[model samples]
Target: MSPRTEQQYEEIREEKKKLIMDTALQLFANEGYHNTSIDQIARTAGISKGLIYNYFTSKEQLLQSLIFSGFDEFAQFFDPNRDGVIEKEELHYLLREMFKLLKEKMSVWKLYFGIMLQPQVMKMVEKEVYQYALPYLKLLVDYFKKEGKENPYLEARFLSAVGDGIGMHYITDPDNFPLEECVEKLIALYQ
Candidate 1:
């Protein structure tokens, strides 16, 4: 066959990059970012360090890429302009979607929560992650306020803390945790 086209090359490159990121996410999440090295990532991913460098200049950039890519998947559900105002059904939909993501994309969220506790990684990624998260947080606060919850911002923060707790529990003990039932109860609590 003739040589692959440019688009095909790019697609292959993206696939390799994703493999590297996924491996690094697991390594960083479990081993800690500072403890992990590019050599470890390359070995885990079954690729050479040079190949990883071709896609990511450094481990910091690789971690940043993983963080954004993980959050980006869930961000689409939080677009406020999509329907102008949030509704109860929309809130339920959002909860279901978030739970689904927590279950289905556990690695991404694991890496996220793991890195959040790391001072070094948090320093590098804090601002961008807050920017990524603010819209969803604001929507939650606004929804609580519209629903007549007292101290809507604090309520929103509590709701977020609950979600984070559930995520941590589910990730830590997924098979034993009643994830779906817990999410249903959480939805009811918010309503």
Candidate 2:
């Protein structure tokens, strides 16, 4: 193939890779990852298992990639801009932004909630997410520390825990949670 033709082929390949990953996530959510097989994923996705391998070497790789890609998407979406550091005032914005994001990502969030309790899945998620989260958490904490908050690290982690709790409550019983209001109330303390 010519260089331009080869480039187009690569683009098409990448799109197929993403399509497989997306279908795999839905199947994994609906059928459970351990129960879902590569052949099933391929059959559901209307592609051959050989084609799936062109994208992901194994089911575990695909699952890990799904989790990692979600984190990557979150990293991008969490930022209001391409700017590296989050301003202190943006902390408030982050709460509503995250809640909105979680609400929008209900399917994936549900998968996340269900899978986290599984030891192997939990380990994989923790390894992938914590590596990504810690630095972002540190950035948030440093922003608070600069603003003269004591124990910024602990406070930052606490906010994450609280947010997770509220998010889970919202997912399970949104009518009862009033999550945005509760989150806003908590954020008031930081101001």
TM-scores of all candidate predictions against the true structure = 0.89, 0.82
Highest lDDT: give the candidate number. Answer: 1
- Candidate 1 lDDT, tens digit per residue, 1-191? 74998899999998998899889988887787888989999999999989998999888899899889877767765665465458888888888888897888888888888888888879999999889878777888888888888898998899899999999999888899999999999999866
Candidate 2, after superposition: displacement of residue 110 in Å?
2.6
Summarize candidate 2's per-residue lDDT along 51-84 as a digit string, tens digits: 9888887788888888778778888877533455
Show model 2 residue runs off by greater than 4 Å.
1-4, 79-88, 173-177
Candidate 2 residue pairs that clash:
none
- lDDT, candidates in the order shown: 0.86, 0.79
Query: How displaced is residue 79 in candidate 2, in Å?
Result: 4.4
**How well does candidate 2 score on lDDT at residue 58?**
78
